[model samples]
Target: MQYLESFYNYLQYERRNSSHTIVAYKNDLRQFCEFLEQENIELWVNVTSKVIRSWMVQLVNEGVSPRTVTRKISTLKVLFKFLMLEDVVDSNVAKHVITPKIPKKLPAFVKETEMDFLLDSIEFGQDFTGLRDKLIIEIFYHTGMRLSELVGLMDCQIDAGNDVFKIYGKRSKERIVPIIKELKVSLVRYLNERDKLFPEKRNPYLLITEKGLPVYHKLVYRVVNSYLGQVSTVVKKSPHVIRHTFATALLNRGADLNAIKELLGHSNLAATEIYTHNTFEKLNSIYKQAHPRAEKMEDYI
Candidate 1:
């Protein structure tokens, strides 16, 4: 328990991990501790690779998905690595365990024409909620910001003069994203409406409900889903789909991968590389349609 407390503090204060991450780590360690107790293992040093393997097998036998078990195994590795560093354990037993491989999944995004229809053709309402919802969709589609970043965004973060807005991304890393010039119209309108509604009391957040309260996560999701459903038939009609649309759009338009990475506040290029598949797909489509020799083999054969 003392070690777990130390690990939690290390993740919170020293590492500055997000709330969701800290909770997941705690749950993983707690589950592992329960397994230890069941096996009559009282000391940290007494746990072995075989014991951990048995636990993994038990979890798999209980019908847990391999991906989930892999996540639990990752949690164990991190915990044991910390314990070894603290001199609480002699060896990191989790290092010997193999993680299950997961199938690669492509990021889901809305088509360019579909997004244009939603933004240009659709007429959102004129009231506070209407203007706010439109701005929400524009920000996600144009900026590629995560849901949490959008939720935590404040009024001061926007730079109307330069067309750039600031985002505090995963792990609180800050990056500047530029909004399209046309989006400024919606931006100005939303701000004007926000100010009009809350004349005496000011909320620090840029996007708020009619009651002047900061927008929460679920409300943002609801707003996105409601509007996206009108124009997009993509299986995923959430804020993340808008993010993927932003990235894929940039890639299709010849934007540099690293620049997109920086704009999206991704920590590494590998994270941004996923959008290349969408780009390649678009290119292959054009090649088959335009090239003279491309489909000649089909006719000749």
Candidate 2:
């Protein structure tokens, strides 16, 4: 517990980790420390790979999912590496601990038709709340920004003259995402309504509540959920699914993978590569529909 605070400070001040990520890392490390306390281990220097394995085994036995266990292992690896760098430990004991293999699950996305219906068919009124709600959905589908980044959007971050959003992504890394003409028009309408209704500066956030306060995560989630529920039957109608929709749409239309990586503000191409699977599925469907030999393969045989 002594070095835990310092480790957290390093993650915050030095690593610039988001608060949500820091809290998750904190919880994971606290659980690991509790495991150590149960085993009568007191010092980080005294910990061993074998002990870490035992902890992992205990987690599996307790019915933790493989993906969750893998994340916990990652947390331990980071913590031990940090400890080694700070000279709190001689070497990284968690380095040799093998993580459980996690199954790759494809990200969920709304269909293009479903998105079309939601954006075009749904009648969001000309009122301020209606304009704000419509703009919220449009921003997610157009920008592919994370929920946190969208919620924390400031008024000045929208570079209208440049036709791009200055998005600050994970770890405070900034990336500029260009906006389409349609999205830009929607954004202009929303800002005008927002300013007209409020008429007083309460917060710098671009999106705000009906009360003119900055929008919170739950509010944004509800807005996306409500609008998406009208058109999409996907189990998750949250902002993230819309983000997936954005990336998948671009990929299906032959946009460069590297271009999508930049637009989504992903730190690595691997993160953006997942959407290719979705695109492949779409292509496979098209192939089946168009190919002459696809329907009756027995003829070829």
lDDT of 2 by residue, 1-301 (tens): 6689999999999999999999999999889989999999998888999999999999999999999998998898889899998898988888888989887899999999999988898999999888889999999999998999999999899887889999999999999998899999899898888888888867899998888888999999999999889997899889999999999999999999999999999989999999999888888899989999888984676
TM-score of each: 0.68, 0.68
Q: Write the per-residue lDDT of candidate 1 for residues 190-210, one digit (tens) a residue.
A: 888878888865778888887
| lDDT for model 1 | 0.89
Off by over 4 Å in 2: 1-102, 296-301
lDDT of every predicted structure (CA atoms): 0.89, 0.91
Question: Which candidate's lDDT is highest?
Answer: 2
